[model samples]
Target: MNGVHAENLGARKAKATRWGTAFLVATAISVLFLVILVLSIVSQSFGYVLVISEVDTASLARNGVALESQEAPALIETLKEGLTRRHLATLEEAKPLESRNREELLSLVMMEIVQERPARTWTLVQSVFQRKAIFDFRDSDFPDGRLYFRSWLRASLLANPQSSSALDSGLRGAAIGSLATILLTLLIAFPLGVAAAIWLEEYAADNAVNRFIQLNIYNLSGVPSIIYGMLGLAVFVRYLEPLTSGVLFGAAEKGAASGRTILSASLTLALLVLPVIIINSQEALRAIPQSLRKAGLALGATKWQTIWHHVLPASADRILTGTVLAISRALGETAPLVVVGASTFLTIDPVSPFSRFTTLPIQIYQWTSRPQGEFKNLAAAAILVLLVLLLTLNATAIILRNRFSARRRTNT
Candidate 1:
């Protein structure tokens, strides 16, 4: 009997070892996949172009000398093939760089070429990308130009807004708007959701009424974000016109009415994410043993006091974690924002609360929908930005949760 028992125990230990090894292997593979995905996106974003500039030939010639190149690169052969000496001189003499006022410069270049050579004259336009070449001069008669490679990548994050492309799309406006929206959502949703959870878990009975409320919360969580967009359109955009539009900028006009304003977007997102906070908070509150609450109450504490002193402190880590997760969700959401009428194009940085705005996801969408291959690469880069932001937020939450857990254990 002892020999048989020993054999069985050995078999069990081997099985446990096998399962542990499999688990570790699976986890490693998953991490590796995520790493590769991120690297791919980073490479694309860094490689893509974002802005194009039109150099004013007359102005540039007046300011600086345009040295002639005997041989242009093979890629620019098409441009060089049809160019007359005068056009080439004009191209060389044009301003080598102009960062802002791209549209005006492009128009000026096109008009100058048209006036000088009534016949088709190819004009050289410069492009900026991030990390790579500073200027890419395209040989074209049309005013159209695109920023490619490294300069574009950097510009996408630094640029304010542009007429033509996502390369002109900068993170400055989107990033700030996103940060403000997230902060507002957290301020509005976290406390309210958590308070409701506390009330439901600590005070409310598990009666039909509470069950009904719980059911509704779950349902609301599942409701399509478009519905919430519609809600914002009705209440915030229409009825609360003063709050949404008039209060900030005298009502939704040409640049308004899309409900694309940051405040509207933020409030709409808050509604979308509120249920998540509430649900997670309730679960966390429930996890704290009832005995702990009873112990505090038994010691002559009121219900609110028991919760404030004992229950809440114990569940603090989980509550914080839930809030962070909700924020992460809000960060990536594009559909609701689109439904709310986020502009795919905007040059001015959103200043007043009611001004139109765009986000990273919308930017990516604009890029991908474009016919150019380079734009697709820009989209990939935008995705990488979002992923990094989400990962950073989540990592911070994990660290905070760990710290809280450690402190709670020490106190106990």
Candidate 2:
């Protein structure tokens, strides 16, 4: 009997070993796939640098090559006058190719020289440690030998709206518009959501009114965002256009009903995400221990005071996590913004609440759909930027959550 029992234990150990091996193999495969995906995106977006150079007309004549009319000397002179001394030096040091050989030269330069500037560096005695910068080449693919990478990135951020030309692809207007919309959305949604949640969870009796409202909140969260876009069009732009005249525009400016301004879009998004924030806050509030509430009551504290001091403070971490997540979702949304009449191009930065706006996601969408291969790369780089922002926000939330948990443990 003892021998049989030992045989069964040995079989169980063997089975566990096999499962562990399988798990490790699966993890390895998943990691390998992720690496391959990243490499593929990098190769498609950044590996190619488009080149359009003016051949040296004299040299072309000497070499019996057909002249393409453009003068290299004039272009070079203009570039030298415009660019800084260091930039000109860098351009001069970049090995040149006759116009025909530009593609090959550009490939070589990108492979060897392109690098981003790091944020920080540390030195200990004679040694230095530095964090290498990661370039979003996939987003800003400047023409080889034509413009410096840093110049191109700055141009994208600074340029005003232009036609469907690469020269016009700047983030100035869109960036400002996005900032305004998000600020408005936060202002409108945060209060409405938090208040709704507080009312539903704390004050409202468990009855039909609460049930109906709770169900509708969940339903609203699931409603297609474009529907809210339509609502904003009818309600804010048409029905309440009188009140918004001063708010949407001043004496020199004009506002339209076609969903052109930041306020309209923000209201649309506020309605879209309000349900999510409400649900999350309610859940967080519900999770707080009833014992804390009872103790507050035992101390002769009012219901509002108990809720404010004990319940909210305890659930603050979760509420913050939900807010961060909702904002992240709002940041990535493009379809509703598109439906609400976000422009594909803008040159000027939005200066006020009534002004126009564009977002990173919308910018990325515009770039990706364009025929120019460079735009596609730009879209990829923008995607990476958005991903990094989301990661940073989530990391902050995680740190806060950990700190809250630690404090709670210490208090207990």
Candidate 3:
């Protein structure tokens, strides 16, 4: 009997070891894939490009009057004098350069007068390995083209607005729009989600109606986000146009032609994230010991007071964890934003909740859709920015959560 038991134990130990090895292998594979994805995006964001200029800076400065040397007013006058009426009108229509500052005017002069275009682009690997080939190609195909190694992710890319020319395009408007929409989404979703979760977990009776509501909330969390977009379109955009468009507040601007504004998109994302928040909050609340609730009640505390002073503080860290997950999901959401009418190209930053907007994901999607290789590089850089934004948000939330958790521990 002892020999037979020993053989069985050996078999079980071997099986457990095999399973543990498999799990480690799976985890390693996931990490490897993530590293590859990040490397690929980084590679596309920095490299060598052959830039061809239609007008040389030397030619523009032949009269010893460089555009950069002039003040804003003089630069504006030079732009008007040097450019044809049609070209000047086009520049103004794109964005009014006259009202802009000296630095902006200088950039515009370079963009319009110099007319620099990327003649050829090389990825990081190609730029490193085929340096001679890149120079030879530029020399043969574009003798006048200058080859320069440029990092696409720069301050100008983050500061300027979107442009038809990728060289002049930036993510400032999109970044602002994204931040505004996410802010609105969090404000709308967090309190409501937490309140609903608290009620469902601590207050609501275990009746058929309550059970059905719980079931539906769980089901809704798994629903396609685009469906929420459609619902948002019908309810927020069409039905509540006056409210969402700020028409009710008498703040609707002339440019806001419809209800497809930042408010509408934010409400859509709020709805999209609500279910997840509620479900996660409920789980967090449920994890608390039942004895804590009984102790508060036994001490003659009101149910609301007990919950407010005890239960919520105990679960605040987990609640924030849920919020972080919900926000991360909302930040990367593109389908619903697209369906709800996020603009693909907007040069102006969102001035209010009622203004038209675009997000980082939408901007990346639009850039990737374009045929130009330069746009693809721009898209990669935008992806890097989006990742950084997400990390920053998550880091801030984590810090708050940890602080709350430490306080709770100290108080106990």
Every model: Cα RMSD to truth: 9.8, 12.1, 1.9
Best by lDDT: 3
Residues 289-339, candidate 3, lDDT per residue (tens digit)? 989999999999999989999999999988998898799999999999888
Off by over 4 Å in 1: 1-36, 48-59, 63-152, 162-168, 247-254, 257-259
Answer with 1 or 2, whichever has the higher lDDT. 1
Candidate 1, residues 1-412: lDDT per residue as tens digits? 9999999999999999999999999999999998887666665554423333343333333224331211223213323443577765554553322322444333333333322211111111222222223332333333354433353355436444433433334566666666777777788888889988988888899899999999999999999878988887777766766676645555554566545577788888889889999999999998999999889889999989989988899999999999899889888888888877777766556665677777777777887797766566557756767788999999989998999999999998
Error of 2 at 19 (Å): 11
- Candidates by lDDT, descending order: 3, 1, 2
Cα lDDT, model 1, residue 369: 92
What are the clashing pairs of model 2? Answer: 138-377, 139-378, 139-381, 160-347, 161-346, 161-347, 177-357
Q: Which parts of model 3 have CA positions greater than 4 angstroms off?
A: 67-70, 84-98
- Write down the lDDT of every candidate, Cα atoms only: 0.67, 0.64, 0.91
Better structure of 1 and 2 per TM-score: 1
